[model samples]
Target: MTEKNPSQKTVSSRQNIRKWLLIISFLLIPVTIFYISPIVAMMGAGKGIVTSAILLYILLFVVSLVVARLWCGWLCPMGAWQEICSPIFKHTVADGWRNWIKYGVTVLLFAMLAFTFISAGGIHAVDPFFGTVNGISITSFQILMIVVIIFLIIFAAAFFTGRRGFCHVLCPIAGLMVAGRKIRNLIGWPALQLDTAAGHCIDCKKCSNECPMGLDVNGMVRQGDMENADCILCASCADACPKGAITYGWKKK
Candidate 1:
């Protein structure tokens, strides 16, 4: 009997995990909004929920620092929605330029904060997801429904053009999460690499195909450069490697 390739097996495992995570997020969203949205509203109304909301936000921030946007990948409802659309539009390209959206989102958030502190407290109205979800009454959520439709459409376009572009570029929560990851040493940064003759990589290009980001994973592996900021630590490249030589770890200091 022929032995199965380890790299292919790894890729399959990672893809399975991604699929299951997406499914779990779909099931978890309603409960999350039911439990958390009220607390947010109460906090805004100065009804003692302020402390609870603050605590919750802090806890989430700490979690982000530790896991580096893993929540965005695995738990966020919008993320799950986007991932569901990814496979439907398969023409993707790696566009590192899209990272510029992070800076724009940061600026926009600060602008909202300034407006909230100085003028009418309407910052929440501008957050697309928040606005969409809470804009109308539960019985009359046409606006929110429309927003969802638009979001799904845009996500589908991005997925077909470039997978996960929405999260990498357009999502404000992801911007915040990425910032938190940069400022903290509390969470260990996961690094992926190979231990053996990395330079021998023949550029078979399987890793890039497997990567959600459409990154040159094979090139990075050849250069032993696993610490690239673009790396999501999903281990897709390791899964796609035909050679069992690919691995992930802390580089020797």
Candidate 2:
């Protein structure tokens, strides 16, 4: 039997940290769900109020300037839920024309938001607690059912399709972060970005296999480029690299 590489062990340990963090995030969904929900945002917008979700969408874009889709990687309850189901469904989702569908969803969501605000004469108030009862989201049986249905949809996407299938093709919030990250790339800011030392790679393919987003990390490394809109900066490739070929660093490009 081949011995385990120390670097591989280190990466595996790091991934475990991410796993536990995701689990904690998932457990806290009841408290945090409304805050990150676009549905809540639209509801608030219709009543001429700015919701927490609106603020978070803005924050996601702003933070993506420095961190890319770190929220998707480390703290998203839905992402955590999908990963929990990943043990039984370890397939990779495809990034095709369907992947672009989320942008249209984002546009429609925001367009409705804008229309609502306009109909209400624009921003009559700002209430981060607009949709919550004492900042708790699943406050009633109806709400609990909604949450359950949403989670079931997320689970269905992951189960019937592949890992992060919802994220890759259906998530409405990802567009904001992707835009921010792309702008950062254009602006050349020293943000949280990945780097690859192709010379250090040995074609073991562990990085590609470890990528939760189902990216071609091995191909990215071979090309000496780790920049991708879909990359959540989870560092799975970096951690899984037995040769330390992939690494994360704060820099542009």
Per-candidate count of clashing residue pairs (backbone under 3 Å): 3, 0
What lDDT tens digits, residue by residue, belong to model 2 across residues 84-139? Answer: 87777677877678678878888888889999999989999999988889888888
Off by over 4 Å in 2: 1-11
Candidate 1: stretches off by over 4 Å: 1-11, 33-57, 93-96, 114-147, 153-161, 184-197, 249-253
The alpha-carbon deviation from the true structure for residue 118 of candidate 1, after best TM-score superposition, in angstroms, is 6.3
Residue pair clashes in candidate 2: none
Give the Cα error of residue 156 in candidate 1, in Å. 5.1
Compute each candidate's TM-score over C-alphas.
Answer: 0.68, 0.94
Superposed Cα RMSD, model 1: 6.0
